[model samples]
Target: MKNILLFIALTLSVHTPLKGFELQHIVEPSASMISLQTQNLCHSLYEQKGHLVCLPWSNPIVDTGKISLLAIAKTNEKGLGIYQRARDKDLNQSFLEEVFRNENFQDISGFAEARALYKNTVFSIIPLHFAAGFKLNNPSLPEVHFIEQRQTQIKLSTTWFLDNPLTEEWMSYFIAPSIYHFDRASSSGDYDVLDSATTPYKDLVQNRSLKGANADLALGWSSKILWLPSVTVHGYRLFKESSDCSTCLPTYISLDSLNAPKADASVSWTIDHSFGSSVFGAVIQGKRLFKSIDQDQSAFAYIYKISRLQSYASLSQNQRSFGFLFDANLYQLGIQYSNEIQATALQPKRINQSYAYTALVL
Candidate 1:
């Protein structure tokens, strides 16, 4: 993992996209490239607004403000012409989904090379699995305070980016509304009702599993500008139902940050907000400093995150959650990594981790 991260850091670092053009436009400039960026951002904003105010909207507020990134050679004719192959410093998750006509371009577009598609895009993603949660009830709820298992019960799920994007510019909305399906496992392997000393739970844990289906919808700015309003909505329930678990609250989260991503290609920022029954906390994450042996072949970026939560929710308190992503590529082969922190209503509080397999196009 460390090696791959190092490689990506190196690959993206020295190959400054903006450094190529002439020194006329502010030390370095590409007039045509700039036009393309301005046009696209304008078109994107118009399209995004249409999604919200039109017939049937899906998610959030507004999308990106237009910004000129490059100077492109205009072709006059149009059928998905290459207006420009621009680069964005802080493309957020949602915008990436919006702009990429063909999602999964990040995984399929040959490692971020400037690709000109006649309105064509290629995309894919490494599947991922996650399981984690923490309990927040008063410690006194349990007669025995000892954790049957120190680890929280892990739930798992996997997804392929059907229409994935490499850069956030492809994404739509201040918070684009996108959907994906997931399966959640029981939050704990341990039991709350029946124990070894107890009759029912002891018998159940022997061959027990907690599993359910979930549908997730994301609402956040495609760009990573901080202090922006963002949100998410998820609907999930066990395949089977019981009296105690029937009315369980659904999951929701909101994040708002003001930090911009690093322009040096060596920094990242993360902000989070989680809502659940037992866990309640907010973490402000930071970027890890980027370092690369080869500034050309590897892309290094620093990342930082902050998380602070009560871990126990109630009428007054709420839950806080977190997620992390890391990846790198060497030549063509590549690997990806991801992590998420969930807090739920349980004892001892739990945390779940996740992993992904990455493939970079040659």
Candidate 2:
């Protein structure tokens, strides 16, 4: 009689609004013994179940006239050890679900950042900007905390814009110099470690402190045509550095492999119509554009602004994000949501994150 009652309850739970609270059970009745088994799978099936969030931050470019100021704060948390493996294997949603079923999911790793920037125009043709930011990443879970990093950055830049009379377009060039500091600490244990003897520069994988200066450069072209988009190419680490400090980053990493110079391009189309402004573009960052799509951090983005309301969406490698912004004369408020793929040594895990930010025009 008890076994029959339990089966009836299970049927109701699966069909009701509490269907997600699925329960599976087995009941055996024998002459001398009764056996019962039960399990609740709701928590295992949901993502972001145990994550702790504190309003992260993200933003879109806002023209704040001659002088502009912006500030941002954000935090991201995720259950580690999801896709901590090589990408060579074929993976599907069902496979990921099965793997997650066996995981003791917990918020074991994440990062937080605080940033601010100031910008102004010089002689109505040169743009000058200053920015500084700090980021911290400390994971408490030993199973996933293979590396912890803290970073500090400060940058100053100036841009020169010149108009082309023949082409009726504008060409701009910018150079930014920055001072950066970082401390990386790695676990001595074998768990979740990416460093191996076979891997190049394995020695640099352990605990280290580095601080140095580098510069970035950008060249851009803009036209008045609706279909002819603006194009910008950015180069990081465009200039070498000289650091005498003991903890300064070695030239090998800065000039050679790890932090070698990198370049990427962005193309954006802007149309100002009766409704407002619509901008859409793509940023591609990789050595190979089409050959290895998965290895690139390329992204397609679109933004629509009708007066004080702005909406944006972006889709990129293993991530999708969308957000909305409201501009109120002096201050702007915005919020965003992102579903990202966090790469790890054991496998690649999917993480859901959110961000909120506000900016002020000074």
Q: Give the number of the best model, judged by TM-score.
A: 2
Note the Cα lDDT for every prediction shown: 0.21, 0.37
Using lDDT, give the best candidate's number: 2
User: Residue 252 of model 1: what lDDT?
Assistant: 17
List runs of model 2 lying over 4 Å from the truth.
1-69, 77-145, 169-205, 239-260, 287-295, 343-347
**TM-score result, candidate 1:** 0.24
- What TM-score against the true fold does each predicted structure earn? 0.24, 0.53
Write one digit per residue (lDDT tens) for candidate 2, span 190-242. Answer: 22223344455445334444566555555655435566656655555655444
Taking the tens digit of each residue's C-alpha lDDT, what string does model 1 give over 1-362?
Answer: 47955765455445433221110101001011111121101111112222211101111122322111111111111112212322434455454333332221110001111211111121111122221211222223322111111111111222222233554534323312222232222222233332545666544332222332222222223323333222211111212232234533322110000011111111212243253111111112112122212122122121121222111111101111122222222211212121111121121222121211222213
